[model samples]
Target: MENRIDFVNWLDPDMSIQILTCLDDLSDLLRVTCVSRCWRQYVIANGLCRQLCLRMFPQLSKVVHVVEQRYGTKDPAEVGSSNFMEWQNLEREHRAYAFLARGCTTFPIRDLISEPICASSTDNYPEESIDNTLEPRDVVAQRASYWSSKGNSNPAEPEMLLYKLMGDLCVITEVSIQPFEAYFQWGLPIYSAKAVRFRMGHPKSPVDVPLGESYKDYENKFIWTYTSQEFPMAQENRLQTFKLPEPVLCIGGFLLIELLGRVQRQDMDGLFYIWFAPSSLFNCSFLVFMVNCCELFQDQCASTLIEYFVILAIIFSHNVYVTDQL
Candidate 1:
């Protein structure tokens, strides 16, 4: 009987890399690393993960340069070591991409908000409390139950929402907002802002300042890290996603959402509404493979579907439980 030769071992290293490059799934790529020492070495040597990350998020190219610059001036002895410099560079890229992937892959929605944060607006009705929009839930009785500011005479004055993330550091890629639609009304008027802006940073002092001092006072003290471009908001009640021009590395945890312009309700008596839900505020991480797949098929299909069912499955299997509170 002839001995069977392992194709992977026989194949040229470059050919193996080319074959592996076709795999877009991060999990699958990670699995390949565990197949054998040869496979692992080949994958690491070529910096497959780093390449995949860069392919997914071109913005990561900037990060790669920053990393290179930080570690460039190594000792001559270290540099002279056989493939040591190459290996080190690849490892650094792998780590950076892994960190970015963690932020984008699985979003802990429940853990997103650090505390019971509220917007700087008066709650008009108890039913339409701001807290209602914090989590995903079915529409309650088809009523416009959402947080609304008191009737503002001048719509130009901006209304703001202040909140903090669960983590001190966050790489923000996208922000989603949903305006409240008064479906119960005749025309189903959607209360939305003409424009929206975001600011992220850390406060100079502890944010536990007295309430009477005002949020504006605390906001003025914050050292902003990034300010997003003013995105035009559509006057639609449904959830709308707005992708930032670039990813923002927010060192500080605080986030401020500014709603601009006055949208009047034709049904309501001259009252301007800035109605929104806490559920509307979504900070989406950019998943490279999913996004690329979507774009690839976008022109062929009427709609693109990029579902993170893994996240949902995990949540259902672990986080959810039957309670006896009833």
Candidate 2:
């Protein structure tokens, strides 16, 4: 052991951090902690594990800080926690990041919408219901099927479609929308929005907003925790996908699709209506073989940082969830 070189001791702190961060695998980082007490202290003290986790999943940036739910009996101010408190907190974060990064494998892509909650408006009740969007094909039972917002003279009057996920937590990656092509109407115009945005979160209250024909009372319904940047839509008769910048773990099960800047107008009515046909809100899921994320649910460590994505796959396997690739 005399001839062995100590990188943490001999190298500059910044250089040492850079070298350790270069390690791409979780096993490589875990080995660094096992090398010696100095290496372990340096690794945890500098927060190499949390840094790597953020590097891998930029979505974790939303989490401002980590606080253990269980606290000491005495206040930290009364008993100095500069050494022990900080060290234990660092270890907790280290363990969390390490567990989240472990055993990542390919997961099947699927739809996360449990059910359609409501639409801002409807052109013709029962005929143009939000439920029609669930059907993949534009034509259902030999008839054109689509959800159409009320013809608004003001194109600026944006429309919204709300949906619920299968679980309380969902890791959302992509959302796909298809503008409806009106074949029955003259010249066959595609009713599409200039841009679209997606929002995900949980409802503020236990009581759900009233759901019925063309419900518009969305105010104070939910607390949106995550909102994606506006994605410009196309006036075509095909599916358009807007993948999120990164995989976002949505704490709440609710999602809202806001259609902005309508571009189509009914020739007869002279009003714009954002028509949607089988808009697939695809949930890009993840699977973890090594880490039992279910256990993290029990520990309650996942509420702030990440949640189990395997829930999406479970819904798919049950054969209730239908996701159309097109």
Candidate 3:
């Protein structure tokens, strides 16, 4: 019988690349690299992951700025001397895209704050406290109550709620808010806001101040890193998610939700009640697994997860803002 080579070995580099390009799943690509030393080297050396990342998130093209800034002053001869550094850059891009994708898939929800502290408010109903918003949706013991602001019909005047994130940097994709509908009341009308705006930043001063103590003067104490365009909210009682135009990189770990417009009043008390759901931070285990297996290349997967894995959680006080009419 005539001797025949294995299918993968028989294929030329170009043909191999063409076949690998058909794989859309990152997991499949990772597995393919493990098939052989030749395949692993081919995948990394050819920057297939970088190509895949670019295809997935075209915005990553902006990474050119990062590359230029990092290597701008390097000698041309040194830069061209070895492809190792180029491969490393591609690996970083690949890892970042993978992490982002993983985050989008698994929306691990958690309450950033156990109880939010009300900062500045026109009025506070003892029963309708700011802490009411943080209660779990399924809690059967407590009826659905919400954080309400005093009657203010002005669109320019807005109520604000501040939350502090204590975890590592989080790439926020969406924020959700629910309007409280008094079902037991005569008419089950929803108390919705005209619009909502978000701001994220780091506090200029230390945030160690006690919940309701020093936060009364928090407005001027923080520096905003990002401000989102106003998003119109629905007049519905159910949970509504407002997706950001693009994912925001929240570095400073403070989120400010600004409620715009007056509450649609049903009774003499012209107030708006917001049924806030606990904000969820996306956490994915696959990202950690991939980082350990693909990036570290160490058999010590257990240690890798312990060292690099981080879960997102928010820690803050029960502070509400009741703004006066502007």
Q: TM-scores for all candidates?
A: 0.52, 0.70, 0.53
How displaced is residue 258 in candidate 3, in Å?
Answer: 0.7
Clashing pairs in model 2? none
User: What's the lDDT of the predicted structure labeled candidate 2?
Assistant: 0.70
Candidate 2 is scored at a TM of 0.70
Model 1: per-residue Cα lDDT over 211-301, one tens digit each? 2223555656776657888999988767888888866655446778888886765455676778875477644443221111111123233
lDDT comparison, 2 vs 3, better candidate: 2
Q: Please, what is the whole-model Cα lDDT of each candidate in the order they appear?
A: 0.60, 0.70, 0.55
lDDT of 2 at 44: 90
Mark the regions of model 2 whose C-alpha exceeds 4 Å error after superposition: 1-4, 12-15, 21-28, 34-41, 55-89, 101-108, 205-216, 282-326
lDDT-wise, the better of 1 and 3 is: 1
Segments in model 1 whose C-alpha atoms lie over 4 Å from true places:
1-111, 138-144, 209-214, 286-326
Best by TM-score: 2
For each candidate, how many residue pairs have backbone atoms clashing (under 3 Å)?
1, 0, 14
Alpha-carbon error at 244 in model 1, in Å? 0.6
